[model samples]
Target: MRDDEFLAERFEAHRGQLRAVARRMLGSAAEAEDAVQEAWVRMSRSDTTHVDNLGGWLTTVVGRVCLDMLRSRRSRAEQPLEPEAPVPAAVPDPEQDVLLADSVGSALLVVLDTLTPAERLAFVLHDLFAVPYDGIADVIGKSPAATRQLASRARRRVRGARSADSDHVTPARRRELVDAFLAAAREGDFEGLLDVLDPDVVVRTEAGVTTGASAVAKGAATYSRHMVGVPVPALVDGATGIALLRDGRVERTLAFTFVHDRISVIDITTDRERAARLKITLL
Candidate 1:
C-alpha cells in the first residue's frame, strides 16, 4: 500500500473525534467537515513519525484550524451558519451520540455564537472535551493562564446567556464575588468575609451545617488559615467554585451557591477519597 493510503487510514481512525471537536467549535456540519479535511491535509504533509500522542496532536491541530475559521467567519460579518446536513434524529454510535447531544441545542448554539473565537475554542475544548490547558494553550497561542481566562469568560457568557431571561449571575461576577470571599478569608478579615456572604448563608460540611454570615465567615477564616494548598478557581458541575490542590491532586472542593450576588450556600466536599474522584480542571 502507498504511504499516503496508510496515513489516510490512520486519519480515518480519528475522524469521529476530530469531527466532533470541529462541529462543536464551528457549529456547522459543512465547516466542521472542511476543518477536519484541512487537518488531514496538514497531517499528510508533515512527518508524524515522532508524534507520540497522535490523537492529542490531531485534536490540537483541528482546534487551531477551527479557531482560524471562526475568526475568518467573524471578519466577514456573517450570521451563525447552519449545518449543511439535515439534523439526524439519532446517531448509532453511543460515544458520538453523546457528543452530538452535547453539541446540539438551539439555546446553546446561540450562546456559543456570542463568544469570541478564542473564548469559544477554549470552552469547547477544555470544558467539553477535558483537553488539558496546556494542550489548549498551544492551539490558542497563549499561556495556560490566558487560556484559562478565555474559557472562564466563555463559560460565564454561556451560563448568563442560557439564563438571560432569569437572574443567573455572570461568570465574571461570580468569580469576582468568590475571589473576594477567599481573599477576605485568607487575610482573616472577619468583616470582609461577612460582606460577601448572604446574611443567612448556610455552609454544609461533613461534620454538620453552619448558618448565618458570621458563623460562615468564622469557619472560612479558620479553614483558610489551615488550607493545605492554594485554592484555585474551577468549574464545579457548571458553577464557579474553588478547588484546593495538593501534590497535583484535589484535596477538597467548595461548591458555592450564589443569590443576589452574595454567596448563599457553600457545599463543601472534604472526603479525600471522593475529592480524588472528581474530574476537576483548574481555571
Candidate 2:
C-alpha cells in the first residue's frame, strides 16, 4: 500500500475514538469531526517514517485542535452546549466494561466542560493520554510545573464532581457489587441483596439527585419481579447496573450508577431536540 493509503487506513480506524474525544472537549459533534479531520490532514502531510506512537500523536494533535476550537467558539455568547452527550445506551459488549462507560463518561465530560480551555487541554493530554508534562506544556503553553498544577486542579474538580455523583468509591468494584445485588434482587432473595448492603450505603442519582435506599430496594424487587431485566440501558458493557431505575429496556439508551452494591444514581437522558443528527433509540 502507498504511504497515503497507510495513513488513511490508520486514520479511518481511529477516527471514531478521536472524534469522541474531541466531541467531549468541544461539546459539538460537528466541531469534533472537524478537529479530527484537521488532525488527519495535518498528520497526512507529515512524513510517517519517523512518527512514534500514532495514537499518541493523533491524540495530541486532536487535543490541540479541540483547544483551538473551544477558544474560537467562545466570545459568541452561545448558550453553553448542553452537557456532553452520553455514550450510547447500549453497545456490542457488556461483560468487559462494568464500570463507567469510558473515562470520557457523560459526568466526566460535564465536569470537563466547566474547565477553562487551558485546563481541559492540559488535563486531557497529560492525565488521560499520559503525555509528559513537558510535552503538555508545549501543547497548552504552560511550564511543566504549571501544567502539572493545571491537571491536578482539573482532577480535583473531577474528583469533587464525581463525589457529588458517585462518591470516592472504586467505579469498577462498585460495578461488581451492583451486578451481584441486581442478580440477587432478580432472584427475589431480599436477604441475598441485603447481604451486599453496608446498612449506611447511600445510593445516589445525578449528583445532587439522591434516591432513598428504600426506593432502590423496592424498585429492584419489582424489576426482579417483572420485565426481562437488562441492566439499565447504556453503551458501557458488563456493568453491575449502576443507576438501576433509569429504565434501559424501553429506552434505547440509559445509564445508572451503583454505590455500595445498591442503586445510587440514574442519568438516563430523554431530550432529542438537538440530537436529530444522531440515530438514537429511546427504547
Candidate whose lDDT is highest: 1
After superposing candidate 1, which stretches have Cα over 4 Å from the reference? 83-111, 165-283
Backbone steric clashes in candidate 2, count: 21
| Counted clashes in each candidate structure | 0, 21
Please give, for residues 1-283, the per-residue lDDT of candidate 2 as tens digits.
9967877998887776687567656666677778988998898888767777777678778888887776665444232454445433123346424333555563354344445677777766665446788877887887999989878766655554455454455656665665667577778777666666543233322222223345456655776676443544223333323322234323222344444344444443323322222233221
- How much is the lDDT of residue 58 in candidate 2? 82
Off by over 4 Å in 2: 79-110, 165-283
Residues forming the 10-long window of minimal summed lDDT in candidate 1: 83-92
Backbone clashes counted, model 1: 0
